[model samples]
Target chain A: MRNRFNEQLEQLNVELIKMGALCEEAISAATKAYVEGDRELGERARSLEQDIDHKERDIESQCMKLLLRQQPVAKDLRAVSAALRMISDMERIGDQAADIAEIARYMEKSAILRQVPMEEMALAAIKMVTDSVDSFVRGDLALAHSVIAQDDQVDSLFLSVREKLTALIAGGENGGLCLDLLMIAKYFERIGDHACNIAQWVEYAITGDYEDD
Target chain B: MRNRFNEQLEQLNVELIKMGALCEEAISAATKAYVEGDRELGERARSLEQDIDHKERDIESQCMKLLLRQQPVAKDLRAVSAALRMISDMERIGDQAADIAEIARYMEKSAILRQVPMEEMALAAIKMVTDSVDSFVRGDLALAHSVIAQDDQVDSLFLSVREKLTALIAGGENGGLCLDLLMIAKYFERIGDHACNIAQWVEYAITGDYEDD
Candidate 1:
């Protein structure tokens, strides 16, 4: 029974990594799509989001089955419950990625986006998502802590993006387009937040300390 | 054992309702503070958010204890898990309220906020929070569905707020203040999303269906 539980735990880890990879792919696709004004990529990102949703449900049932069958206690219970919490964050990351893609569909200001340079912001947010999941998979407490601290970087990037957009307006760029870019930047910041949340859960799962800021 | 579990579940309900009330109060206080430029109310809102955070931690451990002790399966398990999920959303609602308060602290434009009429948006989001919690308490599927649908109203209100802010900028209001107001509107929209999430968890608890949009 212990062997079987361990095997299932291993399976959960694999599934989580797959979900994380999908999230990374989704946001990357959406960001690239928006930056290049590629409608096909936007469409693909939305489909990736649906896959992420299905994975959330799939991983959720897996966790439930682990709980019911193993009746895990103590640290094992925390590990499984943390998986449950982590997936919720992953699901939201997917949603934010798709939301960015949705804006991309309507936004043809690839030049304006390049001018304000949200791609950097998107990359930073995506790195957080990737590192957070990596922290969970490797059980690296230091990585998790760094991921949490990285939120400041993403936030500062967002502020700079806003400043650039505002500067673009002062330079006679369209205010309307700046608003859309601002929304997109906000979505990326939210994705970073979700990543930070995943890292926090990873910390709780490992150290039994949950801190919210 | 079953009776004790039932009592604990009832206790959870009471705690959840209290947390919900705190969320409502926090948002209401923040909105009033922003609209009236009342620093005292903003301070009270921030304090209430701290209370909401404590309530979240308290309820989380309560759910963990119930799960660890009772080893509840099937519907009872679902109920406990759903409460766990619901508190996360409530915590986020508290955060959004405090974020609004933070914005309010720097904003002395009571007249401007009134001109944009975000009071209506705040009230709408607050109602969603109240009804979502009520649905959880009553297990009212219809009410949960209504709360989910009410997101559209909050969203349309956000669009109108955006439109008005744009017009205000066109009319020579500080573009910077409009941007801040826009952020405040987005935060309210996020509060609605969190409320929608809570209602969805309420629905899942009752119907075992989890839908994400």
Candidate 2:
């Protein structure tokens, strides 16, 4: 029984990493779609988002079954519960990524969005998402802490992007493109926040301390 | 022993309702703050958000304890797990409400925001939230379905508000206030989405059918 429990826990970790990778793929594809003005990439991003959603439900039930059957107490229970919580954030990241892609699909191919530096923000957000899931699977408190601390940089980046767009609008730039870029910036910032949430859940799962309340 | 288990479940329902009420209160106060341009009301809304956060942690631990100690199987297990999922959405509702209130705080007192009809949107969002929780606690499938159906109206309302604001900006109106109101509309729309999420979970808990795949 003990050996089987340990094996199932390892399997759960693998599933989590798989789900995390899907989020990264979706975000990356969406960002590529936006940056390159490739509408086809948006379709790929949306498809990956659906895969992410399906994985969420799959991992969720895996965790639930582990809990109901194994009835593991103490740290093991916390780990399973944390996985359950982390997937929800992962799903949201997938949603935002898809939303970004959706906007990318309809955005004017010639929109002046280069000044906003969304590529950097997307890379940063993707790194946070990857690192947070890694922290959970590896039980690396330091990595989780790093993911949480990195959120401020993404937030400041978002603010700077917003300020730039606002300044451009003030200079009589087109509103349609600006609003779209702003929405994309907000989505990246929110993805960062969700990554931070996953890292917090990692802390709780590993050390039994929900540091963020 | 069965009686004790049922008793604890009943108590959990009570806590869920209380948390739901806090969400409604926070959203109502935040909407009033924006509609009336009362900065002080934003403060009150912020405080209520804190309370909602506190209640989330409390209810989460309570559900965890029940799950671990009772070791409920089958439907009981699903119910507990579903409650855990529901709280995450509820917490998000609080965050969005506070975000709206936060914007209301710094927005210019003389900003012309009346054309947006955010008050109606808030009322609609708040009802979705309250009804979602009620449906969960009472296992009312019809109510849960209603909440899910109501989301389209909120989304449509959001689009209409955005169109109005865009039209005004085209007419040479102030961009700052328009952006602020747009952010609020987005938050309310997001609140409606979260409520829809809760209602879906309610369906899962009661019927064991995760329909919204």
Candidate 3:
């Protein structure tokens, strides 16, 4: 029974990594869609969200079954609880990706967004999301802490983008398009926050410390 | 040993509720300071935040001790985990209240604002938070769900406040004051989100569903 449980646990971790990869891809695609105004990419992300949701549920149910059947103690108990917390963060990340895609779709026809730094902020956030998940998979606590440290960069970039958008709006250019772009920038900033949230959870899982990053 | 553990669990719950009440009061005072341009109230809210932070750390340590001692299972496990999660939400709520107080301090001595509805929205949020903590204490899942449901009202009120502020800015009026007000409204909305988070945890502890609010 213990052997079978170990096998199941390994499989679940593998599935979680797969889910994390999909989440990264979704965030990447959504950011690229925002920059290139790619409607199809946004559509792809929306459709892929259902897969992410399904995977979240699958991992959760597996964790629940493992907890009930194995009644894991000590480290095993920590792993299962970590998985549970991580899934919640991952699912929220998926939702933020969909929100980004929706904003991309809204901006598909907007011509007033040229020269804005919103796209740059989105790319930075996507990179953070990818790095955070990679750190989790590698169980690299230092890397996770580094990702958490970069949250301030994303926040500053967001403020810069918002200021730029506000200036454009105030200057009587790109009136309607500025709002959509602003919302997209906000979504990217929020995605970065969620990424930081996941990195914090990863740190907690590994070190049993919930200290604020 | 089991009886001792249960007693500790009860004490933790009581302290968590006490901390929640402090946060609720801070949010309310901060909002009122914004509406009334009362720096005194803002200072009071800011002063109370440190106590909330101290309470949060205390409860976290207590819960850690309980987990180490009891290695609780099933419903007891859920209760302890719920306490941990609740403190996290409560801490964030404390931060949100502080955010509001900061904004209020920034707006102190400014001209009287025309948007009175912000006060109403903040009041509604405070009520939701109070009821959310009450529901947790009483184990009233329905009441918690209702608090979650009221989140939409807070959100809508936030949007309306934003629209009004934007209109004021677009009309070439003094935007500094309006923007500060908007930030206060945003803080209240976030406090509402934290309240919803707490309610979700309450529901999860009861049902283990972990469904979105």
Top candidate when judged by TM-score against the true structure: 2
Task: State the lDDT of candidate 1 residue by residue for B1-213, as single tens digits.
Answer: 999999999999999999999999999999988888889999999999999999998998898778777878878888998998899889888888988999889865646767876889999999999999999999999999999999999999999988887676666566667777888999999999999999999888888778887
What is the overall TM-score of model 2 with all chains considered together? 0.96
Which residue pairs clash within candidate 1?
Answer: none
| lDDT of candidate 2 at residue A145, scale 0 to 100 | 96
Q: Give DockQ for candidates 1 onward, in order.
A: 0.39, 0.48, 0.17
Query: lDDT tens digits, residues B1-213, model 3?
Result: 889888987898899889988988888778777777788888878877877878977886686566656667777777777777777777767877877888777654644365437877888889888988998999999999999999999999987876776666666545445545666676788788888988988988888767653
Q: After superposing candidate 3, which stretches have Cα over 4 Å from the reference? A: A1-12, A32-85, A102-109, A173-183, A204-210, B1-8, B36-84, B105-112, B174-183, B207-211
How good is the docking of model 2, as DockQ?
Answer: 0.48
Give the CA lDDT, 0 to 100, for residue B183 in model 3: 61
Which numbered prediction scores highest in DockQ against the true structure?
A: 2
Q: What is candidate 1's CAPRI-style docking category based on DockQ?
A: acceptable
What digit string (tens of lDDT, one per residue) describes model 2 on residues B1-213? Answer: 778889999999999999889999999999999888888889988998889888988998898778767878878888888888888999999999899999999888754577677888999999999899989878999999999999999999988887887777676666666677778899999999999999999999888888763
Better of 2 and 3 by TM-score: 2
lDDT per residue for candidate 1 within A92-171, as digits (tens), equals 88888888899889865547766765878888899999999999999999999998999999899888887887676666
Cα lDDT, model 2, residue B88: 90
Worst 10 residues of 1 chain B by lDDT: B168-177
